[model samples]
Target: MRRDQRTGDHRHSLPAQAPGPGNLPLELTAFVGRTAELAALTAALETGRLVTVTGVGGVGKSRLAVRAAAAAAARGGAWLVELSAVRDPDLVEHAVADALRLTDHTHRTPRKVLVDHLAGREVLLVLDGFEHLVEACASLAGDLLHRCPGLRVLAAGRRPLDTGGERIFPLAPLPAPDAAALFADRAAAGLAGFVLDEGNEADVAELCRRLDGIPLAIELAAGRLRALSPAQLLSRLDDRFALLTGTRRDVPPRHQTLRTAIGWSHELCTAEERLLWARLSVFCGPFDLDAVEYICTGDGLRADDVLDVLSELLAQSVVTREEGPTGVRYRMLDTVRAYGADWLEATGDAARMRRRHRDWYMGLATWCELDWFSPRQARVAELVDVELPNLRGALEYCLTEPDETHLGQYLAGSLWFYWVGCGRLAEGRHWLDRALELDGDHDDSRLKALWVLGYVAVLQGDTAAALAALQECKDEAERTGSAIATAYAVHRTGCLALLTDDVERAETLLRSALDQYHELGELNSNVLMGQVELAMALAFRGEIADAVVLCEDVRQVCEDHGERWTLAYALYVLGFAAWTRGEPATARELVMRCLALDHAFHDLLGTVLAIELLALFTAVEGDPAEAAVLQGAASRIWPSVGLPLFGSGNFGRPHALCEARAREQLGDARYEDCLAVGARLTPDAAVSRALRASSGGKAKTRRLPLHEGRAGDGLKQGELRPGQRA
Candidate 1:
């Protein structure tokens, strides 16, 4: 069974309240004087498929693009994908996928997944900070436009993306009066009772003029109001930049002015604040107080001092803070981060600080992975979601640094569930493959990563890769005497066997794995899933009663642990057992319940299986038309999963039976029409329709067990698939 592409999950997870808007960041402070630019950008978006907002850093191009995107999102949907932190051209699509919140599980390329997602939608994509990845952005914009007719691209960069059909909207410095007004507003925010009046009005105006009307420089300069008067600020700028002297002709004037403004801010900071600023540059994404306390501590900076110094830096506009889902997170603008990075490099502590940063995230991933099976599973996913950029940065450091390859392997091993459960199989494989190849160590971490690789390959339907990885894991386990590694390898081998229709071998392997898990007291999501797979293999081999017992045990354990991801799989196996028992109503209820849990997590494999089972029940219950439609929908999703029915005769039986029955009863034309109808329905709508069908057309209420007891208790169940025969 295939996993749901992150694109589908991303789309489903969006806020349902306003389908009209996408994930545009809220404009916290007042948009502060971009009226003309906003208007022009909005007009450009109307007339062009691509609109490029081009300007040097700090010219307010991003602000303008955001304002326009929000407006467009109000009409349709607009998503903003920030590209400033993305350094690799190969990762451009992944960056976009992250922005779209696409957790695709398929082995398909990120670009293909994104294209499939946007193909039929009318939405706007705001690519912010595209200057670093201009060529990649241009190609992406062109391809997206070609694939999606209704798609619009809004790019913000120092230079244009240069995609064909782009309407370039050049964003210059804020006009003189607007810049002065911005500085005055910022100054008032910083220093109470400050106003733009006759006293220092000329000095403020001259300061803004000297700063080249760059919004960031104006804002940073304004932040110095508490210590420096407007006249003093102008004098400092003059002394720093030596405006009377000849400026570098090759370099841009605006860049020089902004750099001087930022440099002056840095020079004025206290020693502790300066150190904190430099150390804080290690974070590639937003960070919380706790993280800052940990990563920036030591070497003359105590944990307690970080808060006060952080506030001071915030006052200086070196870091921006916002309340996020978890808590308040702080981030530095690209220009600010660049300045701090320079200082960090100069301090010669860049390498050590980076290692510390990687270590912190590695520890974080370990903690999250250990907690993944508990009630905090959802929260863990959310936490990992927020830290992905930082995590990616850490991974890059570990993989690129020769000495850190082992740590990279360990980190990749620790994030198995996040990569597999969260629909990042291809990326997970990429990291694990690289880390494993770079180093050859026979420890617990390497073993763990090997099993994870095998599992991921199995999900991708690469039997050869799965077997090769599992064989290596098994051989190493025997050599190293690691029982946990042996058990895990055995479990994944069972999964591969089950997927390949070797039910007997699968059942044997799964039983062995379960025994080891029991002996070791290992009760995680992975172990629980092993039990569920055992039940599936039993059911496939006509051991329906025993399968029911195993599934019930798995489900009870999952409920006891408050585990949802594994419970969904248990329900699926149980639902399959119920369907074979010839109780259509019982089967329908169980399958629909399973389908709901699958859809909730965007688990595509579980979802399609439930749907296929539901179709089989409908066929036996005499609603062949609806069954045909459901079958058609499942058919469309099968390709994305890599294998249809996972090549399992047992899993394939119901789908094949349902199709045969529906086609025979409805004939070709009517069957095709009904199929098309089902195909047209979105995944959510299809699930809803299937639930309605399962409920026998009454208002639906969810129930756990389909019947009083487990299946095969003289229920006259007959096999619907290839393997089972009742």
Candidate 2:
């Protein structure tokens, strides 16, 4: 049977798991080698703000953080709010309220309740396992920090709480000496005959170091002293997992094994919670409660129950909740998730659960794609941001599943908004590539996926892949008589051609797409996207005035429709036009606005591009320092998304120009060094390629004249010019 992924309980020990926090009591003896960390944490508490203790799993972050909170109890009451049990970001504050023993009769927002409870209290709130609930934690922490000036927060998780005035202390494993001491201490306490002599001191030290001084691993290893001798255990330390078994029977059996410790937590969950836990195991990052309700709940569990179960899980220290600009979200520890997956499989429901997970994510992607065209594009972006991890998980599952490949393809194609609006070209390319490799029978899905693949490739400067995918998509769409698909494929093909400097073909393909879009009546964001492509083609072909006019038209429609993303692209085009026309100050302002919006939306690729343009504008204005700063920021962001900068057509010209200017001002040696640094920071070719090909191309094209229609089009009636669209 598969092991539970939540608390890492052994498969054999599954039956022994118990419910509630009391069942798995915190053993102070299990916590070791965090003296310095505890000291620093206590010190940070005095300084106030949200003090976050971040570390990898099994590193004893929770134990240490809790210990610190307990210690702080001497000065002021320290309320332990375990967020690991909370699955819904919306209920994050409620979970904390529950932990603090606060009852809200008025149904006030959790934030308000929390503030009221914490307002006058000179207390230390220990919010444990809050990586998943970062945003919620941030808001709560920020509020507490502001309102309850006397209150302090000690947060423990895999990452920092990210609140303003957040004092982050990254907890690493214990030093070898301390770890060895810990092992000896725990071994002596747990086993009657355990002893660490000179002969085995080196071996024990080696073992501690191997465990990376993680307290949980140390405790688990010490528990095994009942079965293995110190020397024998040292020898078997290479396969430590095999050597470590049966340390204590009275303790929760999952606590005996590293994996089982997490699994034990999974075993104790209710059926509904367990199902949600399993479904949620699919995510790769944080997710919101609405996503949980939509993706993880169904016939077995009511969608509304998601909040209740999530709240229960958070309270139980199983699921983690976070907050973002748009709302709260939840996440899981990689180790904990692995344990939940074990239980998920053991329950004989892996395949069905995975399918449900896939379906829900697919629906979400479709919804987001449709919503991207609306005036609430920014709001849609926020929603997507919170759901991205689950979507990626679903895509991954589909790509790996033989029968579900088409779903993966469809999901990838459906995320065009994320790719285009947020400048996630690199990430978009990654999913597209994997999806394309699968044998998808759905022609529409295939066509959409392929077109997106082509778009990503174009962005990454992979002309060959871009052309191949676009050609295939175009052929498939034409064969299937899919007008929408055909239009999308043709438009993207035009984008690729434009990027490669193929002006005439770009014009022809873009024009055809535009006509098709017009014929489609009430065309969605895709139609506007196609228009953007046409405008880009016009710009590249030197029709500057026409391009500007076209961009203005798109800008107005995008705004009228609440399409902030489209507006951002329009602003980008206007900035470029301004640069071409020698309007440096105007270009700077427009590009800065675009950058600000992109950054706010987590559009890393868009932010980078905006920075690149801003850098150029700054250099043109003789501000090398500002230019270098912008260039550096861009260089840092590009690599994460898998974009190649130097040889890629998408960024090559800008990169070359930036480097040359930097070199001219900063001298050849420094400039070359900066360029080298930038080169090294290239985004992953696969992800970047896809993003560039799809969204990047659309954003670029939106600047050209082809999409503007005639000068008398609706765009001219509104003053929403391309320069200030964002």
Candidate 3:
């Protein structure tokens, strides 16, 4: 997520895109004048397993690594893990796993999951903004290189990881001519119909040369074209330089140079723009107009005129617009933001602005959590996805600031949907654990986070941890006299029971939890999922008629409310019922629908379970080879998810039945051969094969529920792993 800013030379932030192969961010701005650097970096990647691109801040080291990775790392897809916003060393692997789109259901650490995933894949890993986490990055990089023969590490930072066999690719500033060309490019974009010509050519060259040929400095200078001629800009730069002279002789000359460039930009902004810029520093990630208006305006800067000021900043290249997951958004270069932060600190307003920033994200998480159950679920997902960096930033602020643990707990609990539903369970657990470690006066917030911790721990197959958290939550609820918290505790306790193969206890608890949800008039993704879990319990207990009735009722409710996540699980129950009644075609169609939703959401638990059932249906349809292959693919997926079939007699029954039948039909050797072949396919590839073959050999992503926003969990419906019996 590095914005490819000047590494380690200044403050840094993140970059975002609308998802890509390995979720590599799209370079928002056109990469200017890096042909030679790109070539050399690519060649270095060709020769070494680890290449650390090092340079001063503003030297475009991150940008070069990204370009090189895109060019040469196409075979295994380029995965970029942004580290500037991540403060916890333990979360680094979590960030990498998330970027690589891995969703493991096991209690294993992210490092183990990453190593297992990378062992045979020819993938490129880009580690951006690693200077702050040098030791962690060095350890991870070395371990990954030693273990994964097909892995290449392209790291961008101010300093090298210094791992053994590391190739440090030191990046220098742009050459004088290239600097001027970059300025010309940025200037022309700022002023329509503008171009570089003989007039003012020398002035532009002098500006680039005087600015040390740094791309960021050149671009900032170019942003002045609307107000100053090239000569006039150079004149101001000279004045700003004279005013900024300091006695810090030990500072790197390049640091001083880059500082002067950013300082000059700050000095030129109007008073309102300056105030806005300083306030804007609180945001370390991409922001949209609504956010700017909400968080950056109102104190001396009027909300009505925020857009005009924003447009002026955009014109000045202090802020640049790009496509975000939600829509059009703007971002400030990290170096510029650092300057603003310094000014904000000097103005004695940093605390206030930070509080404001936290409040905005807190509200966002709360609203998104509530909306996650409604028809606006997809919109909520997209918004949270886009705002994750800032959200993480805000979470960091809450956890690190004194007397803010309660708020941190609340925020962590509020993001349960994003953590569980949006495929960030490990990270969610990380934050929740941290937030819960310190005592807060607010029991409600603490209890909320406690239940959420139990929920995630259950899905991760950590039954002991799950029991501890749920027990604490229930005890705290009764002590506080909170019925809502008590109900949530009861619900997830049922989930734990469901996952541990106690279907009778699970059924009773789930049914009781559903009645509690009804009595309290609670309705969200969580509430709907409680109902679906109840149905799963009934199906596991061999009460097919009741399971059908319950699931169908849940499905109708899902359709009415535009809730697809819970609906997927409801369909899974009906699909199981359909299969039990000897309707193979109907069962396949229903489970395929379920798989489509799970795959779309990166819900690995649901995905593997669906694939398991699909294998059984395929077997019934007389394709034992494909069925065995599907089972093989499921085997490949299970480690990432958790224990295969959750180690539940009930949950494992479907898979065991499929394996036995497929083996009987194909014979042991033939079945084993097909299983090996299917196991070779990646998770996405296996799902693709399953989807196409299920659809009569037709590609079906578009036609599936995904295009309309599909993701669901039937086994506690993501509140718990998929544990229902076939």
Worst 10 residues of 3 by lDDT: 712-721
Tens-place lDDT per residue, model 3, 235-313, is 9988988666554888787888888988888888899989888988899688888878888776699999899988888
List per-candidate RMSD values in Å.
Answer: 7.4, 18.3, 6.8
- What TM-score, over all chains together, does every model reach? 0.87, 0.56, 0.91
**Superposed Cα deviation of residue 604, candidate 1 (Å):** 2.6
Cα lDDT listed for each candidate = 0.80, 0.65, 0.82
Sorted on TM-score, highest at the top, how do the candidates line up?
3, 1, 2
* Model 2 lDDT, full chain set: 0.65
What is candidate 2's CA lDDT for residue 323? 68
Query: What is the per-residue lDDT of model 2 for residues 1-726, given as tens digits with 9 covering 90 to 100?
Result: 233232222222112212222112244344444556678888887666577888777777776776676655523366777666455565567557556644322213457656755665667777887777888778777877788776777888878877688888888777776677677767877677666677777778777766667766676566656656666655665544544445666743334455543443444468888887777776657877766777676669898678898887775556766667777777776666766777678877778777777777788788878877886777887777666656766877787777788888889988977865565554576578777877888888888898888877766566787888888988888888998878777888887776565667988988988888788874666677667667766765567688889888988897778776656667877887776665655676677677666666556556667767755644444444444544665665554333334233433455546555566677766665654554433233222322332233311222223233243222221222222211
Best model per TM-score? 3
Check candidate 3 and list the clashing pairs.
6-57, 6-58, 104-640, 105-640, 105-641, 713-717
Over 472-545, each residue of candidate 1 has an lDDT whose tens digit, in order, gives 99999999899999999999999999989888899899989999999999989999889889888877777878
